[model samples]
Target: MVQPLDSRQRNRYSRQLMIDSIADSDQRSLLSSRVLVAGAGGLGSSVIQYLAAAGVGTVGIVDDGRVKRSNLQRQVVHTVDDIGEPKVESAARFIDALNPDVTVETHATRITPDTVASLLRRYDVVVDGLDNFATRFLVNDAARLAAVPFVHGAVYELEGQLTVFRPGGPCYRCLLPAAPDEETVPSDEPMGIFPSVPGTIGTLQATEVLKCLLDLGEPLDDELLRYDAADATVVRTPLEPNPDCPLCGSDEIDDMDDIDYDDRYRIED
Candidate 1:
């Protein structure tokens, strides 16, 4: 059932309502959507804020980490007061204050193999803001199995990338069959990302999430977009499911059971 926007809602969302593509109905659709954000770090900061600002009805935040003083640099949702608090809690507080009408579900737990399936099944879509390749790959498989569309964003130093994976499209595995060796990939190269890198990429991820929810605009499905902060350039790459892809290929493996997420492989974002 579509809930009509009240006068206060209309006034509060005037700017967004003015957009040609976003009608009151689209706002209502956004209000009814369920989106799960997989992390509460740099990328997650912008994603969570924008989604709440847009009135996504239910936003599930999954993260086990606590806010640290260092996190304040990019994790904008948290503050000095939030340090030592669970990231999920701090994020929930941020959402509640930003949009009280929006319900926030806080899962202060890590996304592990045992928890991934159950966690993902609860939301219509997911936004990836994970730091490690291990958890990122895990979410990809779970999303593929659940048939839910997920927006993936990653930042490295001054660059970032964004993509979307759904049931019928090429998955992350199709883009990279295996994680790169940690030694060759260098785990610490992008030690501390430029704050704006994740911020920009996360904002784009939120845009894609809105597109997926509203069925408006072209989504990043089947394509990879890399954003270079140095020159402010975006490179788009077409993607296709490899026949030998482990997840969504014709001869795909049974499941993600045999895979080792800790086998660090880093793909340049």
Candidate 2:
């Protein structure tokens, strides 16, 4: 039930439509696609920008936080005037201004095990832009249970990582297996992040989303793409689904109740 591109769409996506892999049909797929962005911070900002500009028909933004004066350094979608506004609302405005064709659904709320599954079912793909490991693991587990694709991205200082997990593929749990010891996890100190790090990873996450929707290029299926911004080097490492992975392995997860994420991550004040 794909719609034909109108005059406005043709003009708006002229450059993209010219790509041999992304013609009218692919563009139509993008128009029919629905993507959920997990956060509205640095990575979410970039993911939303490109996804909207590329004419994604529906985008759902989920974040319970509000903008702060400190977030302006890397969260590109929010402005100084939006510092006091909700991140979801600020991000929605940015998307609307970027492309009116895009429909943005904002969930100005926190993501939890109970709500994560419901949130993910509403979208075709999930973009991981969350800053914390707790929410990230929640998303990872939820997407796997829903049998949906999750584009994973993370940034720490000058380093970033990108990966994709879909049904029957290696998942986030396969990589981490278990959360780091809460006691040993570093507190959110003033660890300087090169602004471009998240930008780089977020853009790659967007690229993965587009490719997933269009089925064009090879996805990072079982491989993690790591980027070191300081050295300007990219490395690809192959990953295999852990046979013992409780989430996506021989001991497949049946529901969210059995898992305990409470002690896994501690929120810093």
Candidate No. with top TM-score: 2
- In terms of lDDT, model 2 sits at 0.88
Those runs of model 1 whose alpha carbons end farther than 4 Å from true positions after fitting are: 185-190, 251-269
Cα-based lDDT for every prediction? 0.86, 0.88
Candidate that would win on lDDT: 2
Question: How do the residues 1-269 of candidate 1 rate in per-residue lDDT, one tens digit apiece?
Answer: 66799998898788999999889998888888899999999999999999999889999999999999988888899999999999999999999899986999988998887788888876889999898776888888888878899899988889999999988889887887776667866655547688778889999999999889989888998899999999999999999888877568754345545444443422222
Candidate 1, position 87, lDDT: 97
- Angstrom error of the Cα, residue 82, model 2: value is 0.2
List, residue by residue over 7-124, the lDDT tens digit for candidate 2: 9999999999888878898898898899999999989999999999999999999999999999999999999999889999999999999999999999998898778888888689
